[model samples]
Target chain A: MSEGERFTLAEARDLAVKALVTAGTAEGNALSVATALVAAEADGQKGHGLSRLASYAGQVRTGKVKGAAEPQIERLSASAIRVDAGAGFAFPALDCARDALVSMARSQMIAVAAVYNSHHFGQGGYHVERLAEQGLVGLMLGNSPQAIAPWGGTQGLFGTNPIAMAAPRREAPPLVIDLSLAKVARGKVMAAAKTGQEIPEGWALDAEGRPTRDPEAALAGTMIPMGEAKGAALAMLVEILSATLVGANHGFEASSFFTAEGPPPGVGQLLLAFDPTPLSGGGFADRLEILVNALQSQPGARLPGTRRLTAREVAERDGLLVPAAIVAEIKALLR
Target chain B: MSEGERFTLAEARDLAVKALVTAGTAEGNALSVATALVAAEADGQKGHGLSRLASYAGQVRTGKVKGAAEPQIERLSASAIRVDAGAGFAFPALDCARDALVSMARSQMIAVAAVYNSHHFGQGGYHVERLAEQGLVGLMLGNSPQAIAPWGGTQGLFGTNPIAMAAPRREAPPLVIDLSLAKVARGKVMAAAKTGQEIPEGWALDAEGRPTRDPEAALAGTMIPMGEAKGAALAMLVEILSATLVGANHGFEASSFFTAEGPPPGVGQLLLAFDPTPLSGGGFADRLEILVNALQSQPGARLPGTRRLTAREVAERDGLLVPAAIVAEIKALLR
Candidate 1:
């Protein structure tokens, strides 16, 4: 167990797909979910990667997530589309939205997609990158289960909602920026709680709204929003855009993302795509490169998502090192 | 002069328009500019209010802002419009874009407007609120002259870029959220510098990247971003959306917004409008009220923009208090 196992990207994807299929997910749905998880893993986001399979499988088993459900797409208007994820994995719904957006944005110059009743959307950057690769600028926001309190209150009322943006580069991979509203991801606290560890101060508050370093207390309490009140405000903005505007469950009304209990998460996501060519009159690429050069010329300054790109390159060239225990667990699903 | 002055909203607008017109701004453009400034003052945003009229008039007089330029609008696609601000005041350009967007969004369900070659756009919230008043969800981003540095960089290469969002409520005023990327507005530093006052720590870094309290040194240096690295990243996102995508000057390339020197600033803005009725299938209002109630039910928690609403109500009832010196300054412009 001390020695970890390594798998090529293709092998990892196949292994994940097999495990998901064995857990009763439809083959097409399993493939979509597995691809997203593997991509996240390659980008060094273990919190959203293969680590999520056990809970996901349990949820499917209990019908909290309908493993065979297919997303239904509706053309709401000339430039807007709505997708009902049908209580299934979010990857397929996001894929459906991205596919629709690429063509819609090209035709209309700008387009938007709203997806509801979805599960965990692994690594928001993954969805937006697809749009960038199609020569579009992408912006995405999603609401998860509640883990953050309102700015001055003790009760959790909003998710550590995420926002992501991606733009195509002239001669390189797209520039991707993704961030969670919280000072730190709630997953870090959950991991620390499992390991019986104390979290650093300023990350969370206990149930009485007092700062606490104990992971368990923090888990039962709330994660602190980044930039204090400003971050809390942005979280609420995301909540309204991703959930309320789409008639999906509010953060406080959704089930947990970390457990297989109760109803489906029934969360929602909003994605916007713009065709840079028409928007910029054919100047977007040159202008973007100017800003990129300015950023790179500065000492000690680096573009956002560079680390993720580096991780992806190494994983593609060699293989991803996965913990042996988790690999074994994944294999057990096949048995 | 010893007695402070108070002006009704109409009186304030008239005073501002008179000063601007005396300084050679066209009557139409002056009225638009005065309207925005009055709105800012009513919302308690004094930095963007009448305090800016002297500089605005000076810039107009020097031709740093085109006093007679009419914004030119072109429909780029079914869902996008581009407005050439013609190196004129941003308020007029924003007005034209908003007028076009309300109709476009209603037909397309979502629409975007990109305005370039613009002068200072005061209070990003003001533009978005217009869309919300038209029963559309609105988001706006604008980049100003350079005032912030990239993360870990010593030089200022980005503006105190602002982002604002507004949504209509069921039985209340539209919910508006607006913020600058910097921890504090650069105008506050400018004020402190004029008075020979020191600023608070953590507000800015000296030219050599050392933290400083001296307002003059901070003025020549870069303002610290709101949430450290995350804020810096978001600033870059806004810069690309508002400036680069619209083929306008980058933050570093733009001239000062507060002075009558150099060429026109030629900055840019991006505004997005979504018709909520179709996107939400007629459920947006009820869903938003649910989230709003959840926040208000908490004893200490209040909705965003409540302070601005309170300021507006007071100003509307008792009129805005104008400082004697600023009144004198405006009077001098008339002379």
Candidate 2:
């Protein structure tokens, strides 16, 4: 925002696609990955948006992430699936997993799939929203690299460990809930470091287990577990699902891919989709519709995913906002 | 604990099981259901323990809940499933679901099972702990009858929804978290009312949305959500997965079995279990063991489920302290 203006959604995706393709991606993979990133920005999640292109490009330049590899799925059961991202980024892996889940859930009533060795998947809400659109309730849980410290400790031991859930409502936008177990996402710190700003206390601790506001100290030290032990416990839940259960890296084993990398981060995500219609006896859709109506009727109620839905609507109606700096960075990478 | 002293785990189970059987249950169902309740008390979750015997008895007496019904698998897929509890209580239904899921997970690696048209299942931790005992990572979610309002709403539209997760840990008891998504659970209200104590101001709103100190008045109104909207949103997530996704009652339709009766509450739960060895490889278990070591090393760090584990250890070591009156009340029900 400080070093750029805006571009419409089309222009942003177009530039991204072109840059990714120029970096040696297949046309289809490039387009989808690009669209996914731009969609993140349009949906108000600037953290996962075009800002990531530079890192992606850097990884591509170093052979850390392959752009052209297609994800492969080895189905474990009609309800369980595992996708190896072919050493590629997360978009392809997620797309494969999402498609497989939607199909499996129609008859299975539910499906669980894990994607491993994929790059950071942008805003998990997008995939769950897509699943909701397919008439399936979707829940996603993922583990990233180690981030915050355990409660009463001063060293990092877990990732932000995010969870996102989405359900379709009849004649209404999908209901979505996406959250980070960490009080503040590590991205906020990275953003602060980028902008040279200070953070509030209680969000993180210094190396000596003391609360601090200095972003630099916060980064060099450790983040406080959110909500004290509760957040810490939830993070452990995420680790079990996303790391230990999914056979991916756990805790400190998964390294950060931002500045450096050791083991491809081994991020693992669990995605679940269940057909709502069958579960509802033909009333599930109507019930959610009613639930949404009631939520909307509340004086200040905003149904989950409303803002993102509206944000997407506006982006479609007008144009997507692509910061000029991001565009410039993408352009430079392409050149 | 004023009117009654704690009973030995075995004695409590025996008394509760005898009462339930007298109400109509035949062997296996009675034992499984009784075990769940006794386990709750053993875990120190008195709210879900023998305290519900009276309601369970009333439900049986009125023919609202089946005491001698078998759970049927309504739908089954390799990694997905649905079970109909035959309009029975949830304890047996969940027991069956976990049994099925364990088999599915062994072959599928990950499996999800939902139970429909069932009464309260006592404590979710019991089932998840069982699954974890099988060396699988287990996550459980359950929704009860409506007792909570949406974040900013003044009316009850959600159950005191609970989400629980359990995982195998190294050198420590299984990590388990089971909590309702309300500032205070309904059990707390019941406890306060029984003790003739005033409820907290934000715990719930009295009839007509007035924050009241009277426990009875607050019970008549809606329970305030935990952390406001976050709690409400989380409750919504639980509803979608446990109810909507399971084809059972959601929200207000959930108002039966617990307080009123239109039909049995049809409580539903979604259980996810996966093998950690395959996902985390050889060192995964040891890595978590290290985490357990670190958690214990933290000053004042009592593991999340440690309280229950500690209580059980002490109770086992010192024997349960049962109040004479509680023993008499339980004996009366048994007779």
Candidate 3:
């Protein structure tokens, strides 16, 4: 691969699957993970895309993540399901949850799935988009290892918890919104550090709890929560829902997703599906259109998830331009 | 009453109830509304407190809000309930929902209540706190009359929707969070206008869609959504869930809550309760404590709702120092 290699969506997915399988993942599990990663790339979520493959493979090779572990599902209630990922990659667990939740939600009108003992679930929006495509409203919350501190606290105590929500549309792509509680993703600071660039003020703090623009110090310290105290509170809400309510590891107890560390992250995710037909008694689509029309009618107004949907369309049509270095690194896993 | 007048909690509540009753409200209905309004004052939410009594009484007098309407509850499903507020105040409706939701959540693991044909439900946190006190995780979303424009659009298409969430704790007060999707509440601009003070830039835009610092101009324009586009998206989500799903008036259709000239505001509220004991199989309290300990261990970190709880305690003990003008106005209603 040269400096500017590009691959069709299917080509990139196949390569990812092969690399994961060669690095000791079960073929089926590898395919699921690969499909998600490739979708992320296609949707222009570069950080969550093939760039994550090397680290994932390393974790698998190091036995920090069980490459062939099977998720165990339990029916906690008629409308609630729980899945234990057996310290495996999160994609398979999420897939299992989605299947159960969709069926239950259709019948019960609403259903929830709690997933534990899982690894990183990339691109929360992707999971919800699938449910939205099925005409169900989807919600997802995931807890990661600690990155942001509690409000007014200097010590990191919670993850950069992320929440994603999607609602089905009558004609347009589903409305999707995915946001991290932090002002910005921590990966941006790492990228800045690598490029020897300074971060903006208020993006992060130093070890001494003072704001800093130096990316290195920011990386060593804490990311600033979005909306100040309010964001931290929202992060805590996600932590409690995704971890505490699911009996999974607390953010502080979880290992780093970026490293083949001392143990599997044992993080958790919660997914919910709601049948809008039963809840709204039909006309959900029309009501959604009313809001949508008002939104797009104005200049500069754009719905969330539109960018990713557009990116996906382009990638599906013309393919994705992944970096050459990332392609080589993923291929090296096979060698 | 002079410039500074203090009233005991009972005194304040009694005054509110008497005023409403004098304005033609049923005694029981007046009590419920008074209790809620007095609680708001005690909790330091002046916008929703006794200061709102004048407008409420005027609405009752003008028959904009039915003074003696009885809310009718319908069990939509085993885990879902709906309440028609009978074009009356929202307190009675929320009371009905809370009563039904607690028992249903316990039996069903999770339950939801949607209230329609309602007027303003003040201080959403107050409602969720009730559920949290009952050892349930409470989530509430309410749709108000239009005050916020769609993202990138100057037309006010959605309300400054509010969301409230609360999780129970073992020993500490419940962890509660309530936030409006707007950068600032619309009341602040109104208050500023009354004081002839300029608002901060970025708080709102003028009618022409240009940023403005004049409070009067800000009131005439649309609020800047919190977190830019994300907040508008959230507001839309709330609108769909609370109004569209509940078969209530859309934000665009709802009448003004601050006036007595129109029909009932016909707003809506949706509340969900999750019994953590059943969902988590006990140990819910202990797990919550771990995160609470971590947060409080650091100096300066304080949980949401603590300040309000403390304010309530002080108000109960030392009484509330409300404006003499406001107190006189309430008395005038009785006269």
Q: Which candidate has the highest lDDT of all?
A: 1
In order, what lDDT does every prediction score? 0.91, 0.76, 0.86
DockQ for model 1 equals 0.77
TM-score list, all predictions: 0.98, 0.91, 0.96
Which candidate number maximizes TM-score? Answer: 1
Rank order (by DockQ, best first): 1, 3, 2
Model 1 steric clash pairs = none
Model 3 CA lDDT for position A110:
73
DockQ of prediction 2:
0.48
Interface C-alpha RMSD, model 2: 2.6
Q: Which stretches of candidate 3 lie over 4 Å from their true place?
A: none
Q: Report how far residue B46 has shifted in candidate 2, in Å.
A: 1.3
* Candidate 2's TM-score on the B chain: 0.92
User: lDDT rank, highest first?
Assistant: 1, 3, 2
lDDT for residue A192 in candidate 3, whole number 0-100: 97
**Candidate 2 residue B296 C-alpha distance from true site, Å:** 4.3
